[model samples]
Target: MSDKMKKGQGPADEEQNAQWVASRSLMNVGSLDESGYLNSFYRQGYNLSKCLSESFANAKDAGADKIVFEDTESYNRIIDNGRGMSRDDFKSMFSFQKPNHSDRKSCGISGIGGKIAQCILSNKKTSTTYTFNGDEYLVANAPWDRMFEYGVFSDMITIDNMNQYQIDMFNARTNGNTGTIIEFPRNDDVIDVIKQNFSRNNKDDKQSKMECVYNPCDMINVVFGGFRLDISYKRRDGEVEQMQMYDYFGEESEKYYDGKTTRTIEHYYDARKDISRYILKADDVQDESDMEIPRVGRGYSKDPRKVSAPYEGYIKKGEYVAVVGQRHYTDMDEEPPETIIQCYDDRKKCFYDEQFEEGISDHRAPLYRNGQMIGKFHCSDVKYTNSRANSKSYHEIKSVQLKLSYSTHCTQDNLLDKCMGIQQNKNQFQSEDMPVNLTRLLGYIKKDKATMIYKYFESIRTQPISPSQPSEVEQPVSPSQPVELRQSVEDSMTQRSVNGYVTGPLTPIQVTIALGINIGDLTLETLTRLGKDRHIIAMFNAVNK
Candidate 1:
């Protein structure tokens, strides 16, 4: 540092400077622009309803037992009686890098979930008042107007800045000093943008209750249907509406079954796996006279909306529904398996009954992390052709139209580990176990002869009723009405009918094709042995009759 060390420079300083320059030369340093990042995130399939979900998730994490949503003509407010934050935590809410929660059972893992809501919905000037443990009240103001101007939300204020009037209002709304209130002015531009992205019709018509809360399905769809907290919405008209777990939202034109009965079955927790399974069973008696295959109806078109009832599909006499859920207790130590398989039904969309809509999707089961729904899970990675209602996989899942529901929770106190990787914005999560879970669920239906699913399939296989009530006496098929029996190997086999029944050896493929039995693991010899089964023979004969 002779020329460079004219001042107070040492050999150690020169060596350190050389290393720094060498390191800088070898690597290209890059940084993320907050404004550009946010703009790009919004453009890439980011659902605006997620803003509402993120807020609800934060409220739930704070152990809020009640949440109130109020939408007025000029502003929208959310009030919650949760354990509000301290001054330091309140200020951090506006920071781009928010702190991650320590509760493993939390619905939010990404630290930015709460901040996203504040950033995306903070129009003009936003004020948030909160009190922790019945202590002094504090308020923070976010001047979002300066967000893009400076490409940062740094110019925000957080302190015990609430006036007497603001404190009184907060106490009035929350009924307690330990609570939080977030209020923002109504921005029609943001609302219209959300509507244009999510609405099926995308028309700028008058807002309905379904379209009121940013048009993400409805208020009910904003959160998990089975959310434990008491949620109430104060309408713009001043009418307060309470939301129940299983409120039916069907239209008048849609069909409703009055004969459905529901029962909950709590499964024993596995000590080794630390998982508990719960079943919500919905059963209905089928009327043979009304036996009609489920078909896609109107209201699904692009132009004129003629909404049809969801799940107008056939109802078996006594079959179980399907819905799946899970909760995490401890952190995940190991990486998920690399192989991921999913199932799909691309033909038409399937909506669930209100009782089982903890989550909903077109076809795949809703995938939930902790209590929050992140995405959907399929049976296989590749799309399975469901055009044939008689396909083994499709019929097994669709015949009963079962809404399979199960949940898992952790009792310990580890927050760093997680069973799933919930991606940013929460559109998806790492679901490596989904395929295995779905396959096991289907196996439970087939392997357990004691299950109603087994009994229902057995009923269909053994008896061939011709639009008549089932009877003990097996009557001959009516010659006037001949039902064609289809085969899986239609090209390789011939169809023959004798004595109102098909008399032939039932191959494994034929059994799977005709009776929807999975024969992947069974050998030809194993299937030949099953052909001797009177029930298998009866199933084959019943189909032709």
Candidate 2:
């Protein structure tokens, strides 16, 4: 054999006499569809909220430590005291091909987020002023909306193109020379959305005014690298009101129990897997009075038991925490059928659910991705099983905020892939594996550790009031009921229960058939108000025997 062959390079490598032939196939290059290109930006789930979120992300990426949001009848503005953009940097915002920020801490995945936000808000009429060193301030106006309307995307900007109005607005809003100010023409819809989502009743106000819900100093250790955010809005009476930025993490964390005490689970990283996990579990359960009083703003609710339930979970994967807790299966019974809020007006609905409620507390911890709130953290592995009928040892995890944090050469590519999984607008996650891994992380607790953690939380609950000692949960399945019939009944009950039908009174077996759906679905009011028919009564009687 040839030396090259012996070395695993193959005999072909030694064929110096061989002449290589090159072949090519010709294909037509298609023309760009300008309309479709413009439409693609809108399709990415950008609404007023997401646009604002992108603005904040841009500021954060620029190393901004302080951000201010201003809303008035004339215009809306976002001013950030960060390392402001240079002229080239400002120009890049208009480029379709400009790459997203490569910084690991940056939320700029698509270079076009800021541009798209501008076009969506002001169309072609957008104004921005930026300075790199607080020395020479430059203001530029881009016709982004017009570019979309004409299907002619342009990145060219003149450094001296500021008009008198733009100059005045820029000077009025800009403070330090080393900062950026983004302004778009007044958008009433945007203003209204800000008020709706960010406002909360202030108990201290004699006139019962709603204040902004943000707490700037809260959760500084984690989110946005601890940036300070301030917000102001012009009231209808021409008075300016300063509102606090909504503090999703801090408020949601404390409210896990009594809105007073929270248990912080230290960070956990699996070096073997190159993944990091963090959790904030509720240390104590709510007392009776705590459950009945509804505070204002997010996480404020009367009957938190009905709102969040005993052991429910919530996941947040976007800019803000959801206003309502997980829809209580128990409260549905007492709630009048007519009172159930649906998206009556189709126009009011966006890609995300927007039904606002009084409270932020939920049975589960809100989920976050890279510090932004997303969705709920759920695990099928932590559930009760018929095989372990006598054991109540399943992890009673109150709420968890799961995120991905990894810093390693081998895992950098994996993190890149995870970043790509985020949708263009960054509203929610589309990655299938991302969630599966997070779910596995939830089960990372060792059997002993799980027991220890549960006992610790139980001790906290016992401090305020005596909780009933847990006895072995009786097996819910009845030996008399045919296994096949019971399975069929379980399936039927599950489907019916989901559609809001009351399950017949089948007792332990029914409970065993569906743990979450059965207890959550069946309420005293539902039992009396709905399932009184003879068919249900007969089934109920049949199952008990």
Candidate 3:
């Protein structure tokens, strides 16, 4: 791959591929088909693919990994090593805002998952999958009828001899030594667009150009050396900032891209914690860090992994943190810390675009990879997203005006619950230092630390995405629209209900229930009014249990 990229093209040749020249404007401005459908599904797929790849992109370290965006019009994605779930995880991946997922850690947030991807792509879910280790597996959204001779499935699918490089890669990746692959076929025009839009531009400063036009939000994609935690200024606004650790971190860091000079900073004793982070406005940065805080942006988490429920020992943690980016990255196989805290999306207010609630809060944290989504931190993420740069979304959702807020502090953000909304008390975590055991709670007190921790996390509903990102999450507005699209999807980016979580692919019904709703009644005012207007318990409730 590296040889292909390097030997393939240089500046002048790269310039020939218009895809590199066109900025972020291309994201939102896609070609529409005669059917009025958005024909630029390639960009949509690329956008989603980027997020998926990012989860494993950094190679799980602060240095040594290399993420090189290539010029090839057609590229492939590989998903390997997830032994048991190779197939289930593939099926539920879709384009819906905060769609519920099988792996909920990196992606499971309220409003930042597959659903958001769907919204970007005109509410569509166009994908194909194959599972073969000799035994037949399910398949979806492919043009198998035209190409394959035969295939088989139990319930919903089958296609045979469905040869595609994409599927081959997926298969190879899945089987570890072997796996299945699924690729969406691109339209002829899209092929040109992909080529023209995403060229092999090894321009002068890959740093300067490793940006998505307008969505300057992409800027943070380059901030991995040491992320900027700008929440301090606003955090001091109320009494809130005092106990919060979202503004905490390590010192001595640098930000670099594949082909650009590096940016460095010394945050050896920074107050912010490692997990949750924030940005600094120019003035704020100058005042505090003695440096000009570049224009930063927030990325909502859009991972589509579902959270597993609270089993005794299955505690899991995920972080979509861009340990690597356009410049400096980790080696291909470094393992990040296995803490259960997820590294993407908001915990309190999952996937809520600040615009709906009105701007300027620490909600969206600008995430990076030479400032690219690497597919992890979008204010939203899922099946697909726009590539048109100059679209009205910027003004519609101004940068300075909106933000995504989260917390590593745990206890801070979910103010209503006072538990682990942001969960700052590291003491609560099961560690050797505490010298305390959860056995007393179940057996000691006397449960086990696992149960104790589960209850603890559940009580506060630790949000997955950090509060360091600018955020403004409030209750849903009672808009006159027909019962707003029920939150059918789980945000691979939203925070989970502290203790329990959904582990595998969820049915639409399961997702709806997890979101606490019944899709059948979305349009019914009677159901809406009933929830809005609750009746007294009347003391008659004591009978059943």
Could you say which candidate leads in TM-score?
Answer: 1
**What's model 2's TM-score?**
0.52
Taking all chains together, the TM-score of candidate 3 against the true structure is: 0.27
- Per-residue CA lDDT of model 1 for 1-545, tens digit only, reads 45554553423576776665666586767787777855554553345466766787778778887887776798777778888877666755655544455434566554666655765666535545455456667776666566656676555444666788887878888875577787878656545533332332222344432444432233334345546777666667887756544322222212111112222332323345454222223223321121111122621121211223232332221222333221111122321111000011112222333223222333344444555556544543324355243323342343222233333332222221233334555435555543232334433432221134333334444332222222232332232332343233232233322112343545555555443345563433333343323333344444443
Which residue segments of model 1 deviate by more than 4 Å? 1-32, 37-45, 123-132, 188-223, 246-362, 381-388, 391-395, 399-421, 430-452, 456-545
Q: Stretches of candidate 2 above 4 Å error?
A: 1-31, 123-133, 155-168, 201-227, 234-370, 374-377, 380-420, 431-435, 444-453, 457-545
Give me the candidate number with maximum lDDT: 1
lDDT of 2 at 59: 78
lDDT of 1 at 185: 82
Give the alpha carbon lDDT tens digit for every residue of 90-131 in model 3: 444332232332232221322223222322222233335444
Alpha-carbon RMSD, candidate 3: 28.9
Identify the superior model by lDDT, candidate 2 or candidate 3.
Answer: 2
lDDT scores for all predictions?
A: 0.45, 0.44, 0.25
Q: What is the model-wide C-alpha lDDT for candidate 3?
A: 0.25
